[model samples]
Target: MICLVGAGPRGLAVLERLCANHAGENELVIHVVDPFPPGSGRIWREQQSPQLLMNTVSSQVSQFTDESIDCSGPIRPGPSLHGWLQSHDSDADQGRRGPDDYPSRRLYGRYLRWVFDRVVADAPDTVRVVVHRATAVALEDADNGQCVTLDDGNRLAGMDAVVLSLGHSDTELTGKERQLAGFAERHGLRYFPPANPADLDFDKIDAGEAVGVRGLGLAFFDVLALVMEGRGGRFVPSDKGLRYRPSGREPTLYAGAHHGIPDYARGRNQKGVAGKHRPRFLTADAAHRIRENPEATFRRDVWPLLDAEVRTVYYQALVAQRGGSSAASNFLKDYLSEPDDPGTLRRHGLTASDEWSWERLGQPWRPHEFSDHATFNQWLLGHLREDIGHAEVGNVDDPVKAALDVIRDLHKEIRLAIDRSGVIGSSYRDEVIHWFTPLSTLFSAGPPPLRVEQMAALIECGLLQVVGPEPQVRTDPTGACFLIGSATIPGKQIRTTSLIEARIPKPDLKHSANPLLCFLVETGQCRPYHIPDPDGAYESGGLDVTPRPYRLIDAAGVPHSRRFAYGPPTESVFWFLNETIRPGIGSMILEDADAISRAALTC
Candidate 1:
């Protein structure tokens, strides 16, 4: 029997691919384990709000690797909110003129559960796949095979391979984290975890209380919905977003970050493109041009574009100063007041760090056009080490020299940003605070009326308030915390507490989180951009201030012993470094119970 420890999309996917791609002459049997009732885990089975939608459109969500239905282009082309629901109605509602908006994550979860059921049905007669609706408490490898101990004190017999397709862990509220909980606990504080999309008990809170949110990221938007619209708040339209009216008394929202609010999100309001495209600020050629001479290129082209994107605000005595102007008659008011210059904002609003990244994405910002963009980031920093510039490093706990490494260089910039904010403070602290927040990435894709409406309804209902902006957010003293995106660990920081160890069925503990490492092994990437951690049974890299070892060795040659990590959960990147939350990717996980069974028998 092949044991698939976590039966979320990834586990199902690994099972499906093995079944579809392998010579299944020897029937495969899959022993799928999870605490949730079959089909999906808590992340998918629960944690959904009716109003909170998947970030991606429906065409992009599938559960198989080889069986993909093309999604014409990157700019959202698929079944939208109306299209999905229209299947129930007459054909007339299909073309109704409205926002072809995103749908709730709950609906997407339903899609995943359905796909899992279909996989279970199509397996060969020779395959015998049994799903255990119990938690896997312990796992260890034996010479004969792998032994998996379930929560019920029963140990499943030997298996050829074990796969961890787990999902996000419950947020273990720390002392300080609890202090945040206490804020909403009393004065009727409503707590919102950035990771969860579940419907919180916003009703426990009446209107007129000072409702505060811990992080002003996307989760904050979901919380904004639960209070404003989900409960009873009504949505009214506005240029900035949908305004809300309390079905009862409204509460003032207290949104605090180290930097108040981000300016990058909300998107550009420019109209009448230069030709057809929305201004080709950056493309592959732009990257190539900058590659020729990094510093000069940044000062002229790159710095100008990004600087225009930044929003500056310093509430010196609450005058609501914006971008160096002490007035805001309206969003359009500022336009008429200021001269129509292309790069003038770069001079007044853009700060030093802004200048730093200005060169990062380069003048032409078509991310899809360039692949080796990271090389440019390393080169721009003056190539700290001559022999190796921006190359990978190994060694878990050994210190890496900051003056000579790419990872070291990035980490150094992170530390400097943290320290500078601590001392002199960033010129555009509020902009940086908002940019780094989860909201920055989520809304970066695009925002529709539905989401903004949800927030507005909460406020109008007297259930939400517009707590003014913050200048910046600081890392935990150690900086081990992280910020997330949908399917990537784009952001990293050292925090007060981090995972130290993990226990998996296939006990070849290894660094599994670095997406690059996963791709190298060809085992599979973690579905939904997160490493599985059911029951917190996996090991992790220790929380040392110094950088841990990061390596990429051939899996076949790597020894499977206690001293080394077999696959993720043992090395520096154990559980997904998924600071970015991209849950919509779950539907594409394939399910093949038979392949898992055969792998258990042979490999």
Candidate 2:
């Protein structure tokens, strides 16, 4: 028997691969374990509010391994999310269910369930799949095989091998968070630590209450949706564009982060599933060379190639927009030959201001110092309007969006350069992880354009207030509330009774709230991955595992032969574990799943 824990997207993919590779020579019993349903799992569970939508368009997401995925296992073609909706005749029923449309998370969960059912139904006669709708609490070695204990006090013994595909997991709160929670408890305030937005109880926050939100990423938007539209508010077209109609049940949200701006809106989808930016400068060979280097750092070695790649696209799009397609081709040829020469840019009618700057793009609010909240809010509104304009132009045609889209497209190559101590560990931690990753994410991986439009409308409607840049939140003992201010705009403190941390908890094995992970570490079944640095070993907060099959490594540094782990659990070991598998791209998700499935089958 082979056990698959956490039946989320990754688990579902692994199951698909296992069936595809099954020889059918012997009986195969697969046990799938999770507290949630087999397909949607915790985060994407079908019960989530339909107001919470997927960031990705329907055409891009797929559960099956197609011909695009380069794997040793057989290709199992299946419908993309859009195709599935069409197949079920639900596309027309659900308004705006086109290929480029952002489907609701609940709808996506339904798709995942359909995919799971199809996979199970089409399994070979020799394969038998049994699902345990209980969390796998513990695993132990059992006489040449393994045994998995579930939360329901049942045990499945004699498992050949087990795969841990635990997706997003709850993490222990940090010292500051703990202090905030303690203060809130003492003073009768509400403090929510980092969590999945869907899990948080929004009703606990009183209507018209001043609530301070800590992070302005995707989760903040979810919070915005829940508290505003989820409470019966509506967005109707106005002379000013989308105008928000208040529900009066909405709480006033004071949201801000280090940047004190929402994540950049995703460029409108012009390119379909098959269209992707082909890297010219940051190619596979270039990434390989950087990976092979002993002293390579991301900023020093990798960023140059990445910078060139972005500029190449940016300028080519600029030229194409101005001159023509033929001129753009000639410009690319010349730019490839003399990438550093400013004369080429000059000849193409490009100025220094037209040059791409990731730093500038990331921190657009850095240059200005707002005197007050109103001044800052006005500036922010203008910024959001400009961003929406660019987004409306679409990712393919817009110069800026097309350039930024390179960051998303070339992520695999970037991962290749940084994963598994490819770059020096110290630089990897400080430069790549702390610096570049967040900036790149802010630029590329963001909410849909419509969300940004709504955000602007909310700001105009005076429902959501951006505190300021470089936001700082702390407990106010005197006021008995949370005091949120900013370093950039000082002397402007906003006090609130409710404080919600609008971000997911960072994965830390030592601080994981999951009982199985805690048990694994305490029992020495697994250890946290550490990157080697000259100063000291940097703890990565991810499970240490071997390459390929990703066998879990123990405290004594021995790889467990019968165990494997992947997805968010092994985050720092492999970069960007949360990204879903795209249909046409050679997705690392499918490749990793295929590897683990093949290895597990061998047992």
Clashing pairs counted in every model: 73, 0
Instruction: Name the regions of candidate 2 deviating beyond 4 angstroms.
Output: 91-93
TM-score of each: 0.51, 0.98
Local distance difference test scores for all models: 0.37, 0.89
Q: Highest lDDT, which number? A: 2
Question: Judged by TM-score, which candidate is best?
Answer: 2
lDDT of 2 by residue, 431-546 (tens): 98799878887889889888999999999989888988788888885758999878787566999999999999988999999989999999999999988777787888999999
Relative to the true structure, candidate 1 has a C-alpha RMSD (angstroms) of 17.1
Model 2, global lDDT: 0.89
Please state the error at residue 336 of candidate 2 in Å: 1.9
Model 1 spans with C-alpha error above 4 angstroms? 37-39, 46-48, 66-100, 178-208, 236-245, 249-252, 262-447, 457-462, 471-602
